[model samples]
Target: MKKLLFGAAPLSSRAADVTWLLFRLHLGLSIAIGAGWSKLVNLTTATEAEKMVGGAGSPPDWFVQQVADLGFTLPSAYFWAVLAVWGEFAGGLLVALGLGTRLAAFQLAVQFLVIAFFWYDKPEPLLGMYYQQLLFWAFVLVTGVGGGRYSADYWIWKRATARLNPPAARAATLPAIPVAG
Candidate 1:
């Protein structure tokens, strides 16, 4: 007989479910603090936008310098600044809300990778922001199991599924339409 793993099924299920709930909340909040909050604050201030590019732009000096490092100038840098802020702020909000966790995580991960390779190029072992990015990347990669019971993603999925394949009784309640000639 195969050994029954995880001791008991029900206990294991509850444990997993609780763990997912906590994980989703913590990870989502972390993302919000890391990016969303700053972007949100920046949104309220004109100078913050200028500060972004360190030249009357919202991009940070380093961010703008990176653009110049790659020979991109002016409006391109500004555009990229906007993209970065949105990637962080909007993506973070969605992840925190569990409204589009996977998409947000993926977008953030891509942005981090680009920053790591082109913007900072941190030394081996990766400390500071690089380390944080690494953790965020790993978390998203390891926990790509949609969303938990406490997540909006879960409810949305359930609702969509019910709508797509409703029960027979529910379906029967619909009024018959007239046939076209």
Candidate 2:
């Protein structure tokens, strides 16, 4: 679990790392700001226009009903709707920051998996499923790769390991070289 949470990026080429970083930034921001921030703010400041699109002060009656339609019992439906909203908002933010990335990506993977497979009566089934599947796979990729060397996980790991094996300690452990006579 610690490894999963704090692992560095794979030891691939610099290009690979850079590419991963770019992908991470794009997907993370898309999920965080594009999809999450609005709904999160809607939790307290949903406008009438927002209401029509499933945003309201409390997870939107329409959204809760949709959750219920997914076979969740009412009240419980409310609970689940709220959880999903929070997950999108917080999970996206964590992913964007590359902090606790694997866990956040895993949660998002589960959410997108459900959205792709379980969402009912999608307006454009193929198109919608494509989008959800793309997101699901992208999140799965992040979960597998973890936060790379450029991520907060790497920074934290470096700090923790440095404390455990400081430079002075390392120098002390090394044998001195013999002088040439």
lDDT of each: 0.59, 0.79
lDDT tens digits, residue span 27-56, model 2: 988887556666655543445354435543
Task: Report residue 80 deviation for candidate 2 (angstroms).
Answer: 0.8
lDDT of model 2 at position 19: 78
Regions of model 1 farther than 4 Å from truth = 1-12, 39-62, 66-71, 121-130, 169-181
Runs of candidate 2 exceeding 4 Å displacement: 43-57, 121-128
Task: Residues 7-94, candidate 1: write the lDDT tens digits.
Answer: 1111137678677667656666766655555554443454455535433225455555666665568678767766776677677666
Give the RMSD in angstroms, all C-alphas superposed, for model 1: 11.4
Q: Show the lowest summed lDDT stretch of 10 residues, model 2.
A: 48-57
**Which residue pairs come into collision in candidate 2?**
none
Clashing pairs in 1: 49-57, 49-58, 50-56, 50-57, 52-57, 52-58, 52-59, 52-60, 53-59
